[model samples]
Structures are given as C-alpha cells and as structure tokens.
Target chain A: MLTTPIPDAAETRSNATFDAILWALSRPGLPRNLPEPGEAALIEALLDRECAAYAGDPLLIPVLAQSGARLVDLSEADHVFFGRLLDAEYLRACRVGSDLYPDDGATLVIRARIGQGATVRLTGPGVNGVVELQLDGLPAGFWQERARLIRYPMGFDLLFLDGDRLIGLPRSTKVEVL
Target chain B: MTLASLTKPWAPMSYGFLDASAKRELRRKMVKAVCVPGCQMPYASREVPMARGWGTGGLQVSLTLINPQTCVKVIDQGADDSVNAASIRRFLSRVSGAPVTLDTLQADLIQSRHRIPEEILREDQVLVLQVPNPEPLRSVQPNMSIARQMHGDADYGRMWLQLYEQIVRSGRVMQGASYPSMVNGRHVMTPSPIPRWDVPKLHMAKHLTILSAGREKRIFAVPPYCRVEPLVFDDVPYRVEDHAGLTCSRSGAKGFFMNEVPQDDGTSAFELSDSEYGVKSIRRAEGDPVDLGDTWYTNGELTK
Candidate 1:
C-alpha cells in the first residue's frame, strides 16, 4: 500500500478555490461560495509563470506578481481583473480572441453586487433553460456593450464577484437584458 | 526578502506526481474548456512519466483533480483489466493514495479510452476521455490553419457534404467511431472515438465529460445539461452497432455492447465489453449481493 500524501495549506486553498470556480462556470448565473472573498484566491489557484495577467485593481498587483504572472496590457492578457468596472467602454478593449482560438478570449473578473441591480436572462449551454440574474455595479449599457463585443465562440467570459460569492458568464451564454 | 523565506523544504515527489505549477496551468485551461462547452482549447500539454499518446492527457487531468478522498476508475476499450487501464488505475492510487474502484457506481472520477461505461453516471461523477485526435475536421481538411478558419466561419458545409458522399457511395454512413456531433448547437466536436451506442449517452448527460488529447495539445469539455446532437441528414437516422440481441457467453448478460470472439466451429461467441459489469453480473448470478446501477441503455434501447 502506498502512503497518502497530505495536501498542504496552498494546495488545500487552491483546490477549494478551483472547485468553486469550476462549479460556478459549469452552472452559469448560480452563485458559488469561494474559500475566500475577492480575486486573490483565484489568482493563486490559476495563475503561474506561463500566464500573462492584467489587474486594474492596485491591491491585486502584488498578489499577481507573487504568482509569477507577467503583467501585461488588457488586450494581451488572458486573465483581466477589474476591481470594479467603471466605464462600459473598457469592454471593447478586452480581447474576444479569434474564432480559431476562442480560449485566447480574456476571463474578466469584476466586482459587482450580484443580487440587486439590472436583471438579465441567461440561456446557453450550462443553463437549464432560462435563468434570470440581477447584477449591479456595471455602468450603463454594460450588457449591451458585452453583447456587442462577443461574437459567438469569440468573446470574453465574465465572473462577477460579491464578497465570497461568484457567478460566471461564459462566452457561450447569451445574456438578454430583461 | 530573505533567502530562507523564498526557499522551502524539499520532498521526494510532489503530491499526485505533478508539480504545483503544472496543476495550476491545467486548472486554468480546464476552466476555459468547461466555459466554452465543446470549443477546443489549446494548452501546454506537459510531459508525464508515460508516453504522450498513451492516455497522458487523461492521466494529467485525473492527477490534477484527484485527492485522497477521490475514488478513481480507469478503463481501456471497455475493459478495466486491460494493461493500459490497470496501469493508470494503479499509478493514480500509488501517487495520490486515492481509493480505486472497479465499480462505476462508486467512482467519483473515471478515465476512459474509446468507451463510456454502460451505466448512467451521476451528477457528481466526472468522465475524462483520452482522445487520440481531437479535430473532427482533420479528415476533410488536413491543414489545421484552414480548419480553424472553417470552425471560425462555422463552415461545416464540407463535413455535411462528406457525410452525404459516404451515403451515396456506401449504403449508409461508414463512419463508425469518433462521430462528429454538434455541441450546444454551435461547435462540432469529436466525441473521442466512442461507439455509436456511447455517443447518445453524452447528450444532456449528468456528468461532466472532458476530452483531452496530449499529443495534439487540445482540451475540450461537455458540461452537464449541454446538448450533443449527432450530425445526421433529414431522411437517414443515426444507427448504433447491432449488439443488443447478443448475449455474453460467460456471464449470460445480454442487451449491452458485446465483443465478438471467434469459435473453432466457424461461429462466433459474444462476451460483455464492459469487464467490470460482466463481473458484477456473474457475482449476482452466484447469489452474491451486487448493486447494479442504472444503465444508459435499457434492453438495447436508449432510455428517455
């Protein structure tokens, strides 16, 4: 019999964080509780030397650096973290990737009030049928801008963070402002 | 920062046999793959101890997701006792000390090559399929660059034309395995060379299915509740192998996928393809307690 190796602190935290993120993305619009609030835990679980990241939030810069991800501009970065979205125009600059390599599309993590804002309906792969979600904090015309930017199989994914809660909206999901 | 703070204690080997950085890279790509749901995503397929094409992609995924609490099952061409499946199952348990099971019902993670289990998977279980070739358009379009453009344009006219040509030349669709199916009504993905019977099980399945090709350096996913419609023409319906009427000579089990064995009398005998299921059936026949989970096919027909 082989002896079992115990997971360390870092491994435990990363595993839990990834579980939350995976479940959140698999079931879009449903909130999953992260091990810790905010993007720091997310960075630790996903980023490494192989990744190029962009963090608009100054507080997260050191955390991204610690993970050894190169800080690059929003267009080149695969993972972009905006502490709080200010202007809707920033969505235009985010890379939608090519139809060939849709994975190049950025994963945008932004702070938002998940339950109390503009209501939208989600219908796509992960969704059972139509799921209604309310999100606040994004600027006016945010959903419209997002719809305009994404061309199916070539658009950025969004993860709304509210303290310990996270909701994922993949490029496959069609968002309708209701 | 002090040097002592930067450096840490050394271990004989990393847990699960992969370095932390490799796991993180795979985790990132997995999230992206699941997000797109049938869109092929490229990743830096890291080298494992095994050969690149010999189930390394599925092994890496299983390693990354495994913990001491996970129950893992591995199968090659429907048999749990095959050399490839046995080695992978042992390797997984040896590295992470995760419990290993031959029963599909008890498994939390299943790594398979060329076949999905006959039993219906639960919502909590995950299925990892080792893919030899991930590109469904490779046969029609050899150049990957042009194929990428076709996928981008959603130009599947040639694929349909090819299928139509096969029907015109032959009496029916000649393509047997790795059947190209549309996912979420958008991307057409190769379902990893599983038999026609196994393809329908993925349509709106309860378990998450990840198809990874280590040699090709691609990863894709089919999340639970996603649609996976097999590409077919209007008049001609998709057909599975005619194995439902055959019975396993050894276990006396019938109505599942069977393996044809040649007999000396110029006839053929059939045996259960899913070796573990066959064993469970034998055990139950002997009056031993066995709990057979619900199967995807009921008496040779897919259950609605």
Candidate 2:
C-alpha cells in the first residue's frame, strides 16, 4: 500500500461523476477513458473511501497488503460475502447473484486481464447497436451471473480492467455475449 | 498537453470521467445563469453510470462551482443525516478535497434535495438543487416544439388553466412534488421535487440558484433578485404549505420542509429542518475552518 498525507480534503473533491457516466454511455463497451493514466495510488484511495450513501461509519482501512475498507461490525450483517469478495473468498464458483436481495445483488470486482474483445455483443443506452468487449478466462459464470441482475437500475456497478484499460457497466445496461 | 509530459498533478482527475474541461463546460452554463438573471437554459448532461433516480444533476452543479477554495454542504430529505445526503457529502469531499461538513452554515456551496436549508444563504452562496424531470409540459403535452414555444413566449395560459381546472374539478391544486413555477416571469419551469412548501423561497433569493437532472439530462437556473412565482388565481391566491406540525429534533424548529424516515417497526419519523451550521460553530474552537460559519447559513430567511 502507498502512503501520503491525505492531500487537503479539499483537493480531491470534484464534480466528474456525470462526466464519467456520459463517457460510459457514449463509448459503449470501451472503458471510460481516463484523462490521465490510471495511477495505482488513485484506485487505492477510492477503495479506501466509502460513499456516505452506503451503510458504514468512519469505515476503517485495512492494509493487510490487500489494502481497502471493511465493515467493522458485520456479525449480524452480511460480512461473509463481502469478506469473501474482497479479502479471501476463493475464486471457486462464478457466483453471479446472492440468495437474499437477488434483484439488488453485489458486483463482482475481478482484478484480472479484461479486454474490449470480440466475444461479447453489448448493446444498450450508450451503444448505437451492439458494441464488443472481450475478456479471456474470467470467472466462467461472470456474464451468465450478471444476467441475474439485469432487471433495471438494481444490480451491480461493474469496474473491470486487464492491466491498464478499465470499464464500468451499471445495471441499466444490457450485456449480451455472442 | 500530452499525457507523457506535464506532470503537474490535479491537472487531470485519474478516476471517473469528468475532466477539468467538463467542469469548464458546466461553468459556461453557470455564466449564462448569472448574465440572463433567472433563465433555465437547457444544457447537455452526462450520465455517470449510476442509478437514474440518484442526484446526478446536483452532482454536476457542485462539480462546476466547487474549487480548491470552496467548502460544501449537502442535504437529503432536509436533513444532513439522510442516506443520500451523507453519500453525496463524502463524494464531494473526495472529488474536491475541500473539507465538507454536515454544518450548513460553513459551506461556500450547499447541495440540497426536497428542501432548502432552514438557515439562510448569502449572495455569494450557490444552492444547487437536483431535478429529476425538467420539462414543465412533460405530462401536459409531449411535443418538444410546443413546449419550447410555451417557454419562449411565456404563454403559460394553458398551465394556469390546468391549475384552474384542478380547482374547478377537485377543490385542490392536484399536484404535489415537482411543482411548476414562473422564473422571473419568463421561463415557466419545474423546480425539481422540493414540495410546494419550498417553492416560495426561490423568489428574489439573494444567492443564485441552479438546477440539474441526470436522468433527463438537463440543467437550469434562477439568478439573484429573480422572480420565482407559483400559479394562482387572483381571487384564490397560492397558499404556503405546512407540514402537520413538523420539527427538527436537533434544532427544535418547526414546519420547515421535511422527509419521512422509516423507523424499525415500519412506522416513520419526521425530519423538518436542514442541518444548522449553528451547532458546529459552537462545537469548534473559534479558530479553524469552522469559523467560516459566522457569515452565511444564518443570512436568515427571505421574509416579506
């Protein structure tokens, strides 16, 4: 994990969320273009930051070498799934949807080699028809799994990358792999 | 400005899509808002791959107005504790690195939903309200050409008549949130979803007001000293709404705009007031950023 003084709290805040959304819609399967190269430091910082709309407190950060946030009190909560996803859940079953709140399920963040390849046919609001992006050897059930969450704006918010290229597909999108 | 060179940081944001150019684009819209004095210009809005029901428009406004020097306050359902309010507060704090607070008074800009703050705002303050649907004639008629004509000529006789019809048909206005208004006697527009209760506050507000919608992809504004009046008949004037005796548990204020928070047993609680920078001002020692509270937030209500 990298370390530096939290800049001045004032420096990091910006209004680019809409811009990001526009980028996702316009580009279709292409990853939202980063105006600059994605630095390892920036992603790490975002992971540590938990949006207030989500349930958490001054959520603590754990730097067990896999640096990110963790819910402190999850005994009565769904700690197992989050722990499995982030901390140590094995990459066994390509679990697409959870049992409870199946409609509003979790997004699987795979830190793997994903590509805007030709295996998948993607079309939805942002695309002018079918746009294509490919990933080799992901959790086998990834796309079939996401199909479980495709009702509307009630599913996972996906962020994928191979090494440099990154993309986000919110539930409003339709992902069809041909 | 090749990426290989130009190492000065903060020049380009590494995460999310909005570049400084994007923020600059929004700044252009804001200038028109200032120059025309209460015109709701429709601008192209980008969807930030979030829930459509979310506050994308407010997010855009805050992004444009915020800078290294600005402090921000965000509220949802008229309370700082509301879920969406907290999320946006943390969001803006992340993007701007400008310190954010639950205290309404300390902010240079305040982003709100459902209600304006119980505290007053100043001329310098910019209040960005999130709008879901902007077209006042959306339900009245679907013709874009017709709606544009209606706004261009300020020919709201049809809108006025619809309310009149409501009074004639049912003894009430027949509409609730997403109420319509006339901006500076020109733009007949919808003032987002801030219950009819908060509509009057926009009239001649000292600070500039901006509105945005991410789902509908629109942005609008009300300039300082601009007029924002609701539809009403001469004999039956528009009346202010009261929240069945609503009050803020923290501030002890009553009948401000409020929201219902679902309690554990499926009952609900009332939140009638936006956060007050008043308490935070007292909490912090007289020196730090908290001192910014002394000037605004208590610019107090715009009472006749």
Candidate 3:
C-alpha cells in the first residue's frame, strides 16, 4: 500500500486560494472567502515566469519580481493589480485581448469594500436570473467606463478583493448599476 | 534575493505531482476559461505519468485542483470500475491523500471521459471532462487558423451546412457523439464526444464543467446555469438516443443510458452504463439500506 503525500503549508494555502477563486468566478457576484486576507495568496497561486504583470502599487514590485514575472505597462500586461483603483482612466489601457484569443485579456484585481457601496445588478451565464451586489472604492463612472470598453467575448475579467473576501465579475456578466 | 530565500527545501516530490509553475499556469488558464464560458483557451500542456491521449488532459486539471480534502471520483464511459478509471482513481488517491468514492453524490470533484454522471450534480461539485479534440470546426474546416477566425466572427454557416448534408445523406442526424452545441448562444463547442443522451445534461446544469484536451493543448469551460443548445434545424428537432426503453439485464435498471453487449445467439444484452448505479440498484433490490441521489434524467426524460 502506498502512503498518501502530505501537502505542505504553501501547497495547502495555494490550493485553498484557488478553490475560492474558482468558486467565486463560477458564480459571479457571489462572495467567497480566501485562505488569508490580501492579494498575496492570489499572486502566489496565479503568477509565475509565464506572466506579464503590472502592479499599480509600488510596494508589490518586489513581490512581482520574486515571482519572475516581467513588469510591463498596463496595456501590455496580462495580469493587472490595481491596489486601490483611484482613476477610471486606467481602465482604458487594460488589455481586452482580441476576438480570436479572448484569454489574452487581462485579469484585473482591485481593492474594494463589498456589501457597502452602490447597488448593481448582474445578469449573465453564471447568474440565475439576476443577482444584486454592492461594491465601493472604485472611481466615479467606473461601470460606464467598463461598459464602454468591453465588447462581447472580448473583455477583461475583474476580481474585487475586500480583506479575505473576494467577488468575481467575469467578462460574460452584464452589470447594471442600480 | 538570496538563494535560500528564492528556493525552499527539496522534497521527494511536489505536492499533487505537478510543479508550482505548472499549477500556476493551469490556474490562470482556468480563471480565463470560466470568465468566458465555452471559449477554448490555449495552455501549456505539461507531461504527466499517463499517456497523452488517454485522459492526460483531465488528469492535469484534476491534479491542479485536487487537495487532500477533495473527494475524487473518476469514470470512463460511465463505468467507475473500467481499467482506465480504476487506474486513474488509484493514482489520484496514491498521490494525494484525497478519499475516493464511487457514489456520484458524494464526489466533490469528478474526472470523466466521454460521459457525465446520471445523478444531478450539485453546484459545489465540479466535472472535468477529457476531450480528445476541442475544436468543433475541425471537420468542416481542417485548417485550424481558419477555424479560429470563423469562431471569432461567429461564422457557423459551414457547420449548419455539414448537418444539412448529413440529414440529406442518412435521413437523420448521424452524429452519435460529440454533437456540436452552441454555448452562451455565441460559440459552438464539441461536448467531448459524450453520447447524445448525455449532452442534454449539460444544459443549464448546476455544476461547473471544465473540458481539457492535452494533445490539443486547449481548455474550455461551462459555468453553472450556462446555455448549451445542440445544433439542429427547426423542422428537424434534436433527438437523443433510443435507449430510454431498454432495461438492464442483470440489475433490472431501466430508463438510463446503457451499453449493448452482443451475445452468441444473435441478440444483444443491455447493461447499465453507470456501473455504480447498477450496483446500487441491485443492492437496493436485495433489501440493503441504500441511499440513491436524484438523477438528472427521471424516467428517461431530463427533469432538471
């Protein structure tokens, strides 16, 4: 009989983090708990040498460097970490990829306050009929900018981080500000 | 950074049998796959212990998502005890400390080849399907680049034309498996050669499904509550296989998918494709206390 392999601390954390991420994305507008608070778990679970990441906060530069990912401009980055999105203009430069390769679109991670902001309605593939959420800490006209920039099958995916809780807004989801 | 800070202490093997980088890559790809339902995303297919064509793709996804707490269930063509399914199940248990179960309702993660479970999967459960060919446009357009362009433009004229030709030639849609289905009303994806009977189970399913092709180096997903409509003309409605009325010879289970076994007497004997379900039925008939979950198809009709 073979003995089962034990997962180390890092392994356990990454696995749990990914499970939360997958669950949150599969059910858009639904919040899920991460293993620990912050984007460190997300970086450890998702970033590597194959990624081109752009961090808005300078403090995350060393961490991104340690992941062996090249630091590129917002437009060129496949993964964009906007610690606290202060300007809606930055959304214009995020990569939406092309219709041929929608996967090339950037994954945007931003800090926000969940359940305490403007009420928005979500309707799409993952949603059952309609889902309502409250999100804050983003710049004004954020949803309008997002609506203007995104095209069907060609848009970036967003993850809102609030302490240890996270909510996903995939490209396929249609958000209506209420 | 110092060398010690850059690397950790070496171990006998990496957890889950995949390196950290490979797992990270797969994680990124999976995020993108779920973001855009039914869109095939290319990834770096890594090497595993199994052969490339035989469930390697599904194995990689399973390894990436698996942890010690995850209860895994693997199946091949709806049988849990087949050679391929048994080997994969044993391998998963050996590598990770995850418990293995034959019950569909008890599984947290299921890796299957060419068949979805008969039981209705809950929203928490995930289904990883092994896809030999990810492209639904491969038959109509052999060239991959043109196919990509066609998918980008939502140009599926050739696909409809192919179905039309098949109907004219055979007087019925001859596509037995891997029936082309439109997902999210935008992209047409081949649901991995699962029998026509199994395709309807994916429509608005509560479970999340990830279809990966290792040899083809592609990964796609179908999020919960997503649309998956099979291609068919309005006049000629979509039809499933005619195995609804067939009864299993040994277990007496009926109204589910079955496998036809040829006999020397020139007749065919039918057996339940889902071996575990068959076993449960036989045990229940024997007066054993058995708990069977509600299935996706009730009386050979899709209930949910």
Candidate 4:
C-alpha cells in the first residue's frame, strides 16, 4: 500500500498559475484567470536559476532576482518582462531566435488593459477560427512593430497581463487591426 | 537579499514528482513547442523513476502538468489495464494525489503509448504521447546536423522520395506506424509510432498533443485546430489498416481498431484494442448505464 502525497501551497499556486497560462495560450485572445493577482505568481511558476531574464520595469527586478535568474539585456534574455510600453522599441530589440532553433525565441511579458482598446482579429494555429480582441495601453504602432519584426518559425511569444487576467499571442498568430 | 529568501522548506519529495526547476524548464519548452506546432524543441531530459525509453518522456510531461484536481488516464497500446499503463497511473496518483480513471471521457489528461483513444478528445483535454523518435528525417538523412538543416529549410523532398521508393518496392506503402506528417503546413513531424489508422485522428483536432522522446531529449507539440497531413503522392493515396467491418469477438463492438489474438486452431480472434471502449460496450449490452463519447472514427471512416 502507498500513501498519496498532499500538495503544498507553493505547489498548488504554481499549478494554478501554469494552468491559467496554458489555457490562455491554447485558446488565444481568451482571458484566463491566474492563481493570484499580478506577475509574482507567474515569476514563481516559470523562472529559476537556469533562466536569463530581462525586466524592463525596475519594480520586477527584485522578484526576478529572488528567482535566482541572471538578469541581462533584452537581446540576451530568454524571458523579458516589460511592465508597460510607451514605445515599440522593445519589440524591435527582442530576440526572434534563429531558423535552426526557434525555441530560443524570448517570451515577452507585457502589461496591457484587456477588452478596452483597439480591436484586433487573431488567426492561426491554436485558434479554432478568427478571434476578435481589444487591447489598450500600448504605444502607437505596437501591432505593426510586432508584425514587422516577427518572422515565421523565428519570432517571440507574447503574454499580456492585466491584473489577474492574461492572454497569449504567439508569433505564429496573425494580428490584423479591424 | 538574504539566503533565506532564495530557499524554501525541505520536503520528502517535490509536488509532482519533478522539482520546480525541471517543471519550469518543461513549461518553457512546452510553450515553444506549442508556438511552433510540431517543430522539435530540445530540453534537459531529467531523471524519473521509470526507464528512459519506457514512456518516461510522457510520464515527465504528465507529472509536470498533473495537479490534485486533474483526472488522469494512462494507456499502453490502447489498453488501460496493461502493466505499463497501470504502473504509470498508480505512480502518478501516488505522487500528486490526482484521481486515476480508465474512462477516456472522464480523463482531463491522457498519457498514452503508441495509441490514441478511440473517443474524440475535447478542446479542454490534452494528450501526451511517448515518442521513441522525434525526428521524421532520421531515415532519409543519417546525420542529425544535416537533418536539422533539412527541417530548417522545410526540404521534405527526401521524405517524399523515401515514400516513393517504398511504393516502387512494395505494392503499397510499407509504413505501418510513425508516418511522417506535415503539421501546420510548416514542419514535418512523426506523430509518434501510432498506426496508420490513428494518424488521421490528429488532423485539425480540437485537443492539444505533446509528443516527447526521453532518450532523444526532444519534445514537440500539435496545437488545437492545426493541420496534420500524412505525406502521400497524388497518384497513390494514403491508406489505413483494414480493420473496419470486423467485430470484437467478446464485446460485439464493430468498426474500431482491434488486436488479433492467435488461437490453437490456427484462426485469429479479434478483440477491441481500446479496452475501456470494450468494457463500455459490454456494459451497454448488459443493460447497464454508460456514457460513450463521440469517437474520431465513425463506422471505420474518419468524418473530417
């Protein structure tokens, strides 16, 4: 006979956080609820010593430091946390990885208001059909910048955070302003 | 920062059988795999309680994804009661306190070896397949570096040539399993070693599939609503095993994949490959309450 192990608080939290992230990514443009509010739960679930992180927001520096991730510039980082964008320069500077190894592309985490701003239509893999979404609080021409910088099989993935809600837009997704 | 902030309390074991860092790394790779939709992603194949080749890759992914609330189902060669399936299910339950089920409809996470369940997987569900080999170009190109270059270039002429040679040699395609497929019209991937009959179930499927090879240290994914087309010439169409119209000897279930059992009389008896489906059929025939979800195939034919 064997006894079942009970999950601790940290384990439960990370699990929930990952579930939220996975669900959000699997169904792009759909807002999924995170385990707890803000990016702390995400950092706890995803970051570790093996990661090279870059935080555009100074407030996230301590949290990234606590995860034992080596903080570096946007080009060298595998994960980039840009709290809020007033310019689209970060998208241009982000690593798109190479054609040989597309997995090396950086995962960009940005803060934006969901269901509030410019209406965009998303279509590609992981989407059942065309999904319409409204996202605000980014610099002008952000979508164009992203579209211009990303190349198929060699582009970064984006996760938009708004309080406890988040949405994922992979580079393969075609974003059209409608 | 103090050292105490970086460290946490010690425990006998990690939450889901894997440590936090391993899970994190898997999570990162999974994200990339899903984004690319069938492109192989490299990862550190961490040690688990099981052997490297015996569904350990699938086990690791299941462990990283499992939670107390997740209802897991494990199957080996389409049967849930096999030794491999039973052991992996028990181990998963013992480690994470997640409920184990033999029913495909009730399972939230399905870890399978060599076979996909007969029932249709919903969008909310995930299927993790154990991959013996992740590279589809291995047969054509022996050198891995050149193979990687081929994949990067989307040059699948050699794959077509291999199929062509098989057709020229044999009357039909000799590939019984691990058929090469084009996913999302971008990358060619081997959807594990599933039989030709099961490969059609992955085309524009609603569920997400993650195929990992532990020994090979590679992982790939097929996201929901992605196209997975098996390569075949226009003149020679891809064909599945002729198992349709054959009824299960015991359960009377017809038009599903079957396992041929040899008898002493030199005759073969057929049994339903999906054991749970057979059990459900038996129960339904015995006037017991049972729910059978929609399957991928209908009367031995794929609807889509």
**Candidate 1 off by > 4 Å:** A1-4, B1-5
Tens-digit lDDT string for candidate 3 (A1-178): 5566789998999999999999899999999999999988899899988899999999888889888899999999999999999999999999999999999899999999999989999998889889999999999999999999999799999999999999999989999999
Candidate 1 TM-score restricted to chain A:
0.97
Q: Once superposed on the true structure, which residue ranges of model 3 sit more than 4 Å away at CA?
A: A1-3
Candidate 2 residue lDDT tens string, A79-172: 1122113322232222222221222233333344456334777754334446677765455566775676343322444545344454545444
DockQ (C-alpha based) per candidate is: 0.66, 0.02, 0.86, 0.75
Candidate 3 CAPRI category = high
lDDT of 1 by residue, A1-178 (tens): 4575777777777877887888788888999999889899899889988889999999989889877899999888989999999999988889888878888888999999988978999988778888999999999989899999998788998899999999988888888898
User: What is candidate 2's CA lDDT for residue A119?
Assistant: 73
Clashes of 3: 1
Q: For model 3, give the RMSD to the true fold.
A: 1.0
**Candidate with more favorable, higher DockQ: 2 or 3:** 3
What is candidate 3's CA lDDT for residue A117?
80
For model 2, residues B1-304, the per-residue Cα lDDT tens digits are 2554423355334222354445545644443333233335456566553576689888877866565556888888666777888888777777556677666656778898867765557755778898877788877778866776666556677888788889899998877876788764556778888877677777766665778876776677765555688877778767655564665454444455555667899977765455554344334544455543222122223254
> TM-scores for all candidates?
0.95, 0.55, 0.98, 0.98
Q: Highest DockQ, which number?
A: 3
Which residue pairs clash in candidate 3?
Answer: B178-B193
